[model samples]
Structures are given as structure tokens and as C-alpha cells.
Target: MTAVNSSDEIAPSRMLHRLTVLIVCLVWPLIWVGGLVTTYDAGMSVPDWPGTYGYNLFLYPYKTWLFGPFDLFIEHGHRLLGAVVGFVAIGIVIAAFWKENRRWVRWLCVALLLMVIAQGALGGVRVVLSDRTLAMVHGCFGPAFFAICVILAVVTGRRWRQDSDAERLRSSTSILTPTKKLAALAISLVVLSYVQLLLGAMMRHVQPTTSAGHFAGIVSTHILTAFFLWAMTGLVWLRLRRCGDLTLSRPGGILIFLVAVQIALGIGTWVVNYGWPSFMTWVPGSQSFLVQAKGFVDSMIVTGHVATGSLILAVSAMLCVRLFHRRWQAKQDRLVAT
Candidate 1:
């Protein structure tokens, strides 16, 4: 067997990395559009799967789609954006297989491709079945797909494969002594964030037919989980900062900032969607206030909250991957030295 240098085997391809970055950029907006669809209650606007009003997705009349009702506009636009992301995922898979040498990287791209296909299918099935529960599952799946895009971008970037700082850090076990604990915390945050997002999705997808008590229970749990997620993410950021690793600290800081913004947006979403809860309405004998449903401000705030939650999840996942990569590399270095 020919012995290939590990460094040579994993040589980074700038083009492939750029392609992955493009997919990430495209998928981020796809997630936002998906959120908007849920926010406006427009998931069933088209009333068909993989098509718009019996026309092929791409063949839908541009004029009607553009000048149609608000629900149709966002719903169709969401489909259009999803198609673009799907195409981009295909490109990533092809590029990875052709231009990238790392076996794991190639297979990860294939996994991404599969995930995109599954997500699209899930959306289509939700529409055809007219199932709100399926819609909630579809909503939860979008962020997971987006997180995979982030992972692909991070692993393929020059920073991941060739950064001198990363190399040095990987060689010095002493410097990474706290990384195990920090990485564990980061992973925990990622899991907690996903759970919170699932709860939020349940709240968003609750049908008008659902019981008031059921809705209230989901909302209460979601609100309480928000505070827990905020505190846990904050602690992770603080610990990462103390560790003094820029790679970890930078994303950690971004996660913390995003969590803060998400909390504000969460409040705004509640106010815009269901009026202020009685506890927060300050005026004497004043009822809670709600922005008009599907209004501009309401949609934007609710969609932004959903989008930011995905961003926080992506950042936490990235940080966890980087930390684990360094730890693995450091272990390998110690073995080689011994």
C-alpha cells in the first residue's frame, strides 16, 4: 500500500470551500423564508406539493405569483428559494466528490444532498396531506439542514484545514486542557437550542382548532425554555472566552449575542401574534395588546426570531466541531510523540 501523507490527503480545495460557503449563504435565507411561511400561515397557500396551482414549480406564471395574494407570494417564493438551495446542495455534492480528496468530506456532502432531498419531500408531503403536525416536523428539519450547511462550510474552509493557530493549538495539549469541558458544554447548548426550537415550532404550528389549554401549555414551556437556553448559552460563551481560543470564543460570542436578540424577538413575536400576556400589560385594567395578524411587523419579528434560533444552533455546532477536532488532533500528536 502506498503511504500518502495525511496533510496531502486532506489538502483543502479553495473552490470547493467557496461552493460550500455559497450553499450556506443560500440555505440561511431558505430557512428565513420557511419561517415566514409558518408566520403568515401560508404553507397551504398553493394547495399542491412540488407545484403551484397545478403548474410545475418553475413554470408558475410569474405575473400571478408576483402580484398574487400575500400568502401565495411568500409561499411560492419559499418554494423558489428552496429549489435554489436544493440545486446548490447538488453542486456541493458534485464538487466534493470531484475536487475534494477527504473521504469524510465527500460522504458528508452526500449526506447533505440526501438531507436536502428529504426536507423537500417532507414539505411536499406536508402540503399534500394538509397536516399541521407534519408541518411542525418540517419546520424543525430546516434548521438541522442549515446546521449541516454550516458544518460543511466550516470543515472545508482553509481555517479548518490549514490555520497555523489551529495547528499550534492542536500540538499543545496544555493549551487545550479545558477544551474537553468547554466542548461538552457547547454540545449541550446545541442540544438544548434544538429542543427549544422544537418547542417554538409547536407553538407556531398550533392550529386554531387546538385546545386553548394545550396552546397555553406549549407557550408556557417554550417561554421557560427560552430563559434556560439563554443562561446555558451565556455560560458556554463565558467559559469559551476564559479559555482564550479565538476560534471558539468568536463563535461563542456570536451565539450569546444571537441568543439575546432571539429573546427580544421572542417577546416581540408573542406581542405581535397573541397580544401581550396579561402579566406584562402595565396599564390599570388594560387588556393585552396584539399586533394585527400577518401584519408586516408581526411577520418580520416572528420570522427573525426563528431565523436567529437557527443561527445560534449553527454557531454552537461549529464551535463544538472545532473544539472536538482540536482535541482529536492533540491526542494524535501526543501518541506520535510517545
Candidate 2:
């Protein structure tokens, strides 16, 4: 096996890494658009699968699509963006095959390709079946895919592949115990975020089909989980700061900031969707600011909340991967020294 030095091996890998980052950027907005589709109740706007009004997805008249009803515009735009992401996924897979030597990395690329395909199929099936439950499932899958993109970007980075032996020795000697705990904490945050998102999706879709009591229960769980998510994410940020690793601390700070924003957005979403909770109505001038459901500002706030939640998950996943990689490199360094 050939030894892969950073300077000698980075050019080809850099291209692949950049492509992965592009995919991550693309996926972020795709998620936001998906959220908007739900916010405006536009999931069924086009009333067809893999196409718009019986026209092939790309062949849909740009004039009509661009100038159509608001629901049609967002729904079709979401599908188009999904297709672009899918194409980028294909590019990543091809680049991985040609440029990547690591077996797991190549397979991870393939898995990402498969995931995009599955996500598209899920969206199409949701439309054809006219199933809100499936739409909720589809909604949950977008963030997971976005998280995978982030992981791929992190793993393929120059820093990840080029950890110096001296740096690893320093890291290994500094805070091995704390690193493990932070890694576990990061993983726990990801899991909790996903669960909360699922609860959110349930609350979102259940209101139209199921009873209000069921929706209320899901909302209660979602709201209660927010505090826990906020606290744990903050703890992770503090721990990372103590660990004194700038790479990890940077994203840790981002995670904490995002959690704060997400919490505020959650409250805003509630106000927009439910006309301000009764508890808040007692506040002076609160009545004047109550938001009407499905209005433009309401849609944007809710969509921003959903998009930020996805970003939080992505950052958590990236942090977890970096921490685990550092720990693994430290173990390797100890063995090499021995």
C-alpha cells in the first residue's frame, strides 16, 4: 500500500472534497424548500409525481412555473432543486470512484448516492400516494441526508486526512477521557434532535388528519424536548471549549447558537401557527403581534426554524465525526509509538 502524504495526495482529493461541500450547500436549501412546501401546504400543488402537471420535470414551462401560483412555484422549485442535488450526488460518486482510495470512503459515497435516490423516490411516492404520513417521513429524511453530506465533507477534508503525528501525540496526551465523553455527548445530541424532529413532523402532519389531542401531545413532547436539547448542546459546547480544541469548539459554538435560534423559532412557529399561546397573550401588546397562520412571515419563520434544525443536526454530526476521528488517530499514534 502506498503512503498518502497530504501535499502529494491532496489535489485529487481536494476536488472530491469540494464537490462534497457543494452537495452539502445544495442540500441545505433543498431542505429549506421542502420545509416551505409543507409550510404553505404546497406538497400536493403540482398533483403529480416526478413531473409538474404531466410535463417532465425539466420540461415544465419556465414561464408558467416561475409565474404560477405561490404553491406551484415552491413545490416545483423543490422538485427541481432535489433533482440538482441528485445530479450532484452522482458526481460525488463518480469522483469518489476515481479519486478516493479508501474503501470505506468510496462506499460511503455510494451510500450517499443511494440515499439521494431513495429520498427522491420517497418524495415521488408521497406525491403519487397523496400520503401526508409519507410526506412527514420524507421531511425527516432530508435532514438525515444533509447530515450525511456534512459527515462526508468533514471526513474528506485535508485536515482529517493529514493529522500530524506530533499533533496526535499532543491530543492523545491532553484529554483522552474528556474527548470520549464529548463524542458521546455529541452523538446523544444528534439522536435527540432526530427524535424531536420526528415529534415535530408528527405534530405538523397530525393536525390535519388526526385529532387535536394527539397533535397536542406531540407538540408537548416536542416543546419539552427543546429545553433538554438546548441544555445538552450548550454543555457540549462548554466541554469542547474546555478540551481546548479549536476545530471542535468552533462547530460546538455553532451548535449552541443554532439551538438558541431554533428554540426562538420554535416559539415563533407556534405563535404563527396557533395565534400566540394563551400564556403569552397576557403580555402587554402581545395581542397586536399575533401572526396569522400560513401568512408569508409565518411561513418564512417556520421554514427557517426547520432549516436551522437541520443545520444543527449537521453540525452535531460533523462534531461527532471529528471527535471520533481524533480519538482514533490518538489510539493509532500510541500504537505507533509502542
Candidate 3:
């Protein structure tokens, strides 16, 4: 009886861990794919808001799969993936309720599930209303949801949990110390990166052809924002190096590398569309080379961008927490040496 009880208790914990991992993995890639679909104006390809054709998910027209291939596949595929993620998120929340020991973690899991559902609803409205604003808002939500999921995964990781318990983890294991200013700068960069993501989504969602002039203006604005993003990331790295903490410094270096790669992709997109007449050639009625390249780059960049953002945010959070938490440890070490 005792053995059976122990086994049963372990089952839920393992199940919940698996579910959390599933949610985090799905959330990030889906956000990138969702961004791609939006950039291509593939959202309305299905011509139905929540369902494929007139049928539900599995019942969607077989023709969609075979005859006269359409944008419907790309768009609808994205929606179907989104639905799968939503279900997984709910499973995670439910698992949290049953398996998690902490009340706050459970509540956060519940809240995250609710947020994913709301994000799905927002996606539907973006389709039904056909509003670019709603589409941008929906796009922004994907990354935000992904970030929260990433945080949840990190908190539940064995390493993080072990660090929480080990006094050695809390000790002055670092020969180099970080100042408060460096930590603050890291936090600021993370926040700014998120804002840049929102702007990128907006630029992708808005119909530039309607007002070619206006669209061009917005594109320029987007490019400028990208430059600022690069600058901010560089500053963050410089500050971390100044702190002389290689632990933080290495991830900062990685982020800097990712940002450079993203910038190159962004410029590649412009070169591909060099002769294009309009920014949003990818919209349903008008698909062009520029549109296709934009679609591909948008897909590739957004996914990488979101994943990089998660990395930046996670690293920043850890750096800030450890810098603050280690202050007393640093002082204690100095006193003992004296």
C-alpha cells in the first residue's frame, strides 16, 4: 500500500513536468509561425474565422488538402497549431493544480492558461473583424504568452530549483561582482526588446499598399526601430562586460550575436524586395516576389526573434535576481577575509 501510494504521487508530478515542457516548446515556435502567417496576410486564407471551410478542424474540406492549393492551408494550418497549443496549455494548468506544491505557482499556471485562451479568442476576432489593429494586438499576445511559458519552464527546471536551495548557489561563487546599474540596464534592454517586437508585428500586420506612401513611412519607422534595438542590445553587452562577470557576459554575447543575425535577415528582406512597388504584396489578392520573400524572412525572423527574446529575457531575469541576492554574500565574504 505504501509503495502504491508513493508511485501514484510521483505520477502526477512527472505528468505535470511533461505537460509544462510541452507547452513551452509549442508556445515559442507557434508564435514565430503565427508571425509568418500574419506577415503573408494568410490569416483570411481560410475565409472562415475559427473553422476550416464550413466544417470543424478535422472535418475541413478535403479539397483544402488536395485540389487547387491555397493560402488557406498556411493560414488554417497556423490556426490548427494554435488550437493544439491552447489545449496543451489548459492541460498544463490543470496539471499544475494537481501536482504543484506552491499556491502561487498554481495560480500563475491557471492565469497563463486563461491568457492563452484569450489570445485564441483575440486571433478569431482579428479574422472576423478584419482589423489590422486587432491582428497586431494578437501578434503581440503570442510572444507575451510564450515568454510567460518560458518563465514557468525555467522556474520548474531542476537547475533553477536546486539553485534556490543551495547555500553555495547563494554564496560569492563569482570572483567578479555586478553593480546595480548594470542589472538595471539589462532589465531595460529586455523591456525595450519586447516593445520592438510589438512594433515589428504592427508593421507586418498593417496594409501598406492601401496608402503606399504611408506604408513606406511605416516601413522606414520599423527599420529605425530595428536599429535602436541593435543599439540597446550592444549597450547591454557592454554594461555586462564592465561588470566583469563572465557568467552574465557570455549570454549577453550570445544575444548580441542573435541580434546581428536578425539584422542581416531584416536587410536581406529589403534587398529581396528592392524593386517591389508595395510593402504588403503578400496580402491575399496580391502575392509577389517581395511578398514571398517577406513571408519567408518574416517567418524565419519572427521565430528566431521570439526565441531570442525569450533567451534575453530569461538571462536578464537571472542576472538581476542573482546580482541582488548575492549582495549580502559578497559582503560576508569580504568580512571573513578581513
Candidate 4:
């Protein structure tokens, strides 16, 4: 790798990759705190837009927010983190346009910036109107933004460049055939995982008019989607492992693991929100299960569940891109050979 780096290759900007990584790191905690905001129902805690309690967000007195009610702390903190993310995103766009050589990747950075702005607008609008539906949209969109940041980070990394070289080398060797199934399966997982996350968000942000029957139907759908998503992740991993390509296989394994962890977290979240199901009343511990409202364990479990869903989305996206890169490289290698 050092040899490659020191060679005639046109290297990407180290500073830009670092900023890309910086934004990726920033978005995760933003998502976590955003999750915390929803878990604690703190979206309206501050009760003002573009500012907290009528004070500029950065100028909001630390004495008030830091030592204020838990909801205030989390909500104000979420805004603070969001502002930081926006700044970093702006920085990424500047760096990308100024230094990034690839035209499409530069456009990707622009898309990422637009997403950040739109996500911020969604959050502000959710607060100003106090709309649960928009809150749910805000919640669902955070993961999607996080997914984009994760992809951008991977694309800008040194490892990504190395992978391209590896792909070209593999294509030259002609040791492996192209995989239409992997590409199709990967894209399918990307879409399905996102849909599952959306359903999960709707379940969390139930409206007042949502009756027991409707909510139960949602629960049923969520559980069924989880099962199918789990199976798809497993199949993606199997396909990648069979190809013996670590770049794709590692993320494939990670994707399936995140899905498994997400399933367990979903169960934990259900237990926290609704207690053990009524059907389990005959079981030992089921009789004693009491759902805690806003308890410590409850918040972490629910927040973790949301964060894990974002991770599943990110890893699945990574797998899809790498598989495409491999296939494209294979095609190029065949053309060169002929």
C-alpha cells in the first residue's frame, strides 16, 4: 500500500479525505442524540426555531441548557450537534469542489450538502409546526443522511482507492466471473433495509388517531420486514464470501451482523415500550414485566435500535457500491484483454 501511495498514482487529497471522515464521525453522534431527542420526546423542549429559548443557538447560555431539564439538555444539545454537522458539511463541499478530481464525487458532495440543509429544514419545520408526521420524517431522514455520509467517507478513503486497484488487478487475472445476482441482491437489500427503517420510524412516532388495531397491524408488518431483511442480509453475505473478495465480504458480514444486532435491539425496544407480549404472560418473567416510560434503559435501548438501523443501511450501501465497482472493473478488464 505504501508502495502504491508512493508511486505514480494520482492521489486524492489527504485533507479532503480527513474532512470526509470528520463529517462521518460527526453525523453518527448527531444521529445518536437525534435518536435521544425522539426517545425522550424532546423535540419541542426548546420551543423555538434556529434558536433555543429565543437565544442564538451557539449563544444560548450553557448555564441554562447544560443544567436544565433533561429534555432541554438533550434537545438543545441535539441542535448544537446539528449546527456542527452543517458546518462540517459545508467544509466538505468546499474541499470537494476545490480539490476533488472526480466530477461525480464532487456532485455527491453537493448532494450531501443539500441533504444536510434539507434535513435541518425538516427539523426546524417540525419544531415550528410541532407536527408529529414531520417529526417522523425528520427521524427517518436522519438515517438516510447518515447513510450518505458513510458512503462519502468510504469513497474518499485511501482504502477505497486501494480497492479500485485491487478490482482492476482481479479483472486482469480473470479468476472470477461477474455476478449479476450479487449486484441485484445488494441493490435489493439497500431498498429493503431503508423501507424497514421507515416502518420502524412510523411505529415509534404513532399518531393520536392510530388505534390499537392499526398499531398492531404496524407491529406485524415491522416484524415481518425484519425477518425478510435478515434473510436478505444473510444471502448477501453468503454471496460475497463465496467470491472471496474481502472488500465486499467484510462489509457483507458486518451488514448481517448489524441486522442481527438490530433484531435483538428491536426486541429490547419492544420490551421497553410495551412490555412482554400478552401471549407470553404464562412465561416466568413475563408476568412481572412492566414497561418503563422514559427510563434510562428504555432510552438507550430505543436509541441504540435506531442507530443500529442506520448502521445496517450504511453497511448495505457499502456492499452495493463495492460490488458494482468489481463488476465494472471486470468488464473493463475483459475489454482490455480482448
For model 2 the local lDDT of residue 240 reads 83
Candidate 2's TM-score reads: 0.92
The order of the candidates by TM-score, greatest first, is 4, 2, 1, 3
Residue range with the least summed lDDT across 10 consecutive positions in model 3? 1-10
Question: Which of candidates 1 and 2 reaches a greater lDDT?
Answer: 2
- TM-score, each model? 0.91, 0.92, 0.75, 0.93
Of the candidates shown, which would achieve the greatest TM-score relative to the real structure?
4
Query: Could you give candidate 3's per-residue lDDT for residues 200-281 as a string of tens digits?
Result: 6655565555487777776787778767767876777787776565656776777677677766666554544453335656
Better of 3 and 4 by lDDT: 4
Tens-digit per-residue lDDT, 238-302, candidate 4: 87777767787788888878888998998888888888877667878898877667688779989
lDDT of 1 by residue, 171-284 (tens): 544454446677778789889889989989888877778898998898888888888888887788788777666787788788878888999999888777767777777855
Clashing pairs in 2: none
The 0-to-1 C-alpha lDDT of every candidate, in the order given, reads 0.82, 0.83, 0.64, 0.83
TM-score of 1: 0.91
Clashing pairs in 4: none
Question: In order, what is each prediction's RMSD in angstroms?
Answer: 2.9, 2.9, 7.7, 3.6
Off by over 4 Å in 3: 1-14, 61-63, 66-70, 170-172, 175-178, 207-221, 238-247, 274-338
Q: Which stretches in model 4 have alpha-carbon errors above 4 Å?
A: 1-9, 166-178
Check candidate 3 and list the clashing pairs: none
